[model samples]
Target: MSRKPMLPDGLSSYLAERWRGIGLSLVIVVATIWLGVTGQLGLYIHPRYFIFTTVMAVLGLVFVVSSFVYRTPSSGEPVSARRRAVALSGSALLLVIAAVTVLALPPATLTSATATQREVNSGGLDGAAAAEDAAALVGTGDYERLSVKEWVSLLAQSDDPALYADKTANVTGFVLPDAADPDNVFYVARFVVTCCAVDAQPIGVPVYQPGWKATYDTDDWVQVTGTFVSNPSARSADALAVLPTTVEPVDQPSDPYVY
Candidate 1:
């Protein structure tokens, strides 16, 4: 008859005994890889980090596979009693529960309400770049491609409305009514993600039109197309607001965040 192999003791035994933690770690690794492969990772993080996620997932799988080589402790084995008790604590189980919960839940993007609560920068362009960009765009007559961030920068840097006058803009963003602005004006905002959702910055363009509050509900995504006109009467005296010729409701983009 073949003899049974002896089990590991002490810390080695403790590590091997927590197989559930290893398994849950694998579940999380798989979930992350799936998100990255399906391009759903963009919902939580910037696209640039997807490659790093893939690398980490691969390393995790290797580590989990290697863990199986460790001999599990037998029930009758002489383990350090106090250390064994600590190894089987609630903290480890709670971590497994949290990991499983995250894996089970559907991914969701931050909403317009989140944008309202966050620090919003209409424009953060430096004075020099803002001036240069404002000058370069003066005669270009192109406006349809301008993002909410670009518009915000232009608004902050250029005090003159002529720099924006006769310029048309077509911007897509979710609607968030600026409670402080007139009923005609609402904010079209996009979350600018650097690394992940935690550091996302909300940047918006103010849309000016009467009765917009009644027409568009908060969080409704829309494509606002119109001329960029100076609205001195606007809440932000410096902003050259979009005078929307057509505010059409649109479906949200799959990757809604602006990188």
Candidate 2:
């Protein structure tokens, strides 16, 4: 007599119980194709998306093949052992792929300059010192709170001296692209957040200097040490301003996102 296959009794009945897994596999395949076609796959963990997608396709194929093979009565041997081995192997492979992809991806904090500044400023630094320094330069009479749109206009229309007459005003922000001029200037900006990073609206000052172009790229952390200079071409009627101080480059601090 031939030996029985290494499966529990009623193994054929048990195989029929797993239709849910097969259906799920079909759904996954459809979703993956849709995401890939729509260009939304980049929103996920970049490296793992493709690997997981491939795994889904393979799993679906395996289920289809297994279902067909197991349906044959003469192929007698219980498939339970083989099925369990396949399940365990696929699961282990998936976990390993996930781990590798996560490790290889670029850290999100490293890509955000605003995050870097917020992390440093939040540390037990001297807030009073910063405020006092700003006050001394802006002066009680000269310090004016302007709306973001107004600020943008002033930057576009006015010269820097109008705001920097006192010559020591302090401004803080991250860097953003300049729509008006890409080659010569960029916006030093900060995102104003209502609750967290999600709703942040960027506000920035336009920086214009021939030397700044050569010395710094966008997103570098630097302290501007110069007095304010007004640019007449800026949109602001109030005179768009910039600190002419030397830029002191700093390392990226932990918890880089501000909003």
Candidate 3:
């Protein structure tokens, strides 16, 4: 009886490696292009790098296609069957995981849950760039138009109530509770994305409102129109907190994060 020929262990391993490379490459390329096309790339990366990332993804895809077209001959060396099986199974598992994580999952931004993990305005805002931006806006005398980033920078410089008392703040962000006093203090905050989402930093202006959680829960997007006042809550670390005249629920903006 005649039997069908099978690939030698070495050739099988070689093909497995090629498939693994191609699968992972495809997952990354597809995810990048899909995010770009859908305008959801910003959820993961800064808006400035969007074009560069898309271009690189396109180049990667071209190379992947070229690799597929240009078939490679395998080395006819012997390999242990046990080793070959383990390698093949491992490659398949990796490919499946990459595909699921990069392609299958829905895109999302950092939430207040994540913001709580990091100290509010911990870093990246007290630096020159943010100070420069805030300085420009401060000159403009349009305090109402200032973003969470600018406000955070301004607060870091000086939390003196006199400096901000008359400067009305009309800021929008997700609600994140004050760790010191969750009852009477919370922040109107947004994640400041540096290079990418992994390096995002939460920065915000504190709001002093007793029974705030009864009206608005954590992570809810809201527009807070108020003026700064000395924080009433002794437990809260902030020197000044927004005494909100109105805290209205708002939809999460198209670009919820600050760059």
Candidate 4:
């Protein structure tokens, strides 16, 4: 008898079933490698994992490539027609979904939508530690150099308008509106990711800009430079806010997250 092909009708289901996992692995391997190569892996994963993830992906790819060269002989045990069809279709569906979701979607940093939904500064960022970090900058009078996170923490600790008075804040971040007082209070915000994008906590220096919505939309990156003063809006709960002297739209920073 002539040797049958590995994918002869009934046994084709076996190959599909066996290789479905491999197909999914291949998608992950390729996506991770490509993202790492393009310097976009930071969009999803933590920086610490960059080397490890890429290294493991390369190893996985080697296994996947080698597996193609050394195919195992298919078991010819008869499978019921219905069962065989289900296996083949299931594998195809899974592989297609994995490939499209992982490989086709462009890598992107988490946006302001995520910040708004999660409630900026709700994550347990330590106010005291933040205050300690900002202490050195306090005496230097170089307040414009303060970061959104540093300012948030310092403001959180004191909220005494006196502490921030006359201190100009020149900070850049995506706009995140204050949920309670949206029209008048919006944040010049950055996402603080402890481990990865998934754990990102939004921290911002509130900008009390009434009618800001008329000029800017949420997630619009801006550079705000002005002194912190008492929040002018009745609706905003923040005691101290940056009353911006210049709020100019700016391109999103190359790396938007604060690790």
Candidate 5:
């Protein structure tokens, strides 16, 4: 008489029983790799963390592969159908959500609308410590290249705008109108992302150019070149009001943040 084939004992049967878990794990691995490869991860996180994140994902993938290959047999009988249904539902729900979010919503950079809603750190939250750090870096030379965060910190740390009056600022960022006074003033702002987009903070230098409102709209990325004029009405104390010599439209940089 022909005998019925038996289910493979050990890990293979275990994986087969909980195959949904394995499938979800594989999906995560694939999604991570896709994000890293496509460069879309930068839209959601700081580039500095990408390497570490990808490394961890790779390790997880390795674990998944080893587990499948080891094929340990389950000593116990298969789980009950009710329990199986619950397990499958939970795992499938998570996988579907993640997959749909990644695939359905196109990745996008946060705009000035978000800037208005979130805290705009013209001087930054670190207060004195950030100011000191900015001062330290200023000594490294090339004041023309001061970052939005540095300019913000400097203004916050020092009350004197005369110190920055003669300096020239060459910065790149999107425009955000000063809501209190939209026509004559606007901020050239960049978001600071320490880890991910969720924690991004806007930092900007205020520009005072007549007709600025007519010339540019909010969220227009531009290269701003200007002379610093220390003015308390400016965005911050260290932020000298930029009298833009040339506010030229430019394509957004590949890496838009201060770092």
Candidate 6:
């Protein structure tokens, strides 16, 4: 009878031991998927889905290579040492890539009002003013007076009445979709970029008051004077906030992009 093929002793065992790494890789993949679906990916170091997906793909390739190496026969040429070395090197490289990718990504906080403080301090009514107003409003217990839903409704209503009401305030941002009617109401938004445009996020206040369209185009630069209105049953009951105001067309100052 032909002798049974002698199997490598540690090969199977090594693969079993490395199963943990595979599990970890799977965890990362699942987490990436979850974040992408929930829009929570925008909260991460690299908010862009494509970036996150690329990093995950690299990791998956590493894991696949590891599995192949782990399953190779040990007795054929005793390449266990070389295989282990390669696995470790590959793992290290993958880790470095992930780290660098994350670090190099733009900071998602660019959309945050806190990140806009410098612009506000340097003679702009950007984030700093918004923060101050938000803080003051919150401090006076006025925030408790209206829910996020209420704020959206008040901002979406016909600006004709509000215009007559003389509701004028100041707001800063780029342009975006309107909360009430994206086609109708113009959104003044800012593209918040932490590191690059790849991970930039657009955040801003909605302007639906009369004459807003006349002064601002899709990407026109402008500073708006408006009033904050609150009413129940807006697009987003908890997050919709709008500013009904007269938009004053302004020059696109240097660094027009929020990033």
Q: Please list the residue runs of candidate 5 whose C-alpha ends up more than 4 Å from where it truly belongs after superposition.
A: 1-24, 63-100, 103-106, 122-141, 230-239
lDDT of 2 by residue, 141-231 (tens): 5443432223333333435465546544344444544544545555555444433344334555666654455777777755444445665
The predictions' CA RMSDs to the true structure, in order, are 5.4, 13.6, 2.6, 3.2, 5.2, 13.6
Which candidate ranks first by lDDT, i.e. highest? 3
Q: Count the backbone clashes (under 3 Å) in each candidate.
A: 1, 26, 0, 0, 6, 7
Candidate 2 structure, TM-score to reference: 0.45
The residue-by-residue lDDT of candidate 5 on 1-259, one tens digit each, is 9653243344334644666777678778777777888887787788888998888889989988776677565668866544555665677787788777766566679899889987666322476666777777678767776777777777666646678766778888999877665667788999887788887888888888867777787899998998777543544333457888999999988777765
Candidate 1: stretches off by over 4 Å: 1-17, 72-100, 122-140, 232-238
Query: Local distance difference test, per candidate?
Result: 0.73, 0.48, 0.88, 0.82, 0.74, 0.47
Write one digit per residue (lDDT tens) for candidate 1, span 135-236. Answer: 565447666766776677667666487866767878899987665674767778888887888878777788888787778888899999987777644465
Instruction: Give the Cα-based TM-score of candidate 6 against the true structure.
Output: 0.34
lDDT tens per residue, model 4, 1-259: 8665446664466566577877888899999899999988877776888999999999999999888677776676667556766787888899999899988877677777887778777764766677777887877878877788888878777777776666888999998898889988999988887777888888888899889999999889999999888888788778888888999999988778876
Q: How do the residues 27-142 of candidate 3 rate in per-residue lDDT, one tens digit apiece?
A: 89988999999999999998989999999999999999888788787766666666677777888999999989888888877998788789987875547888899889889899
Please give the lDDT score at residue 248 for candidate 1: 96
Top model number, TM-score = 3
Backbone clash total for model 3 is 0
Give lDDT tens digits, candidate 6, residues 67-105.
Answer: 756665444434455465566566656655664554444
The Cα RMSD in angstroms, rounded to one decimal, for candidate 6 relative to the true structure is 13.6
lDDT of 5: 0.74
lDDT of 2 at 155: 38
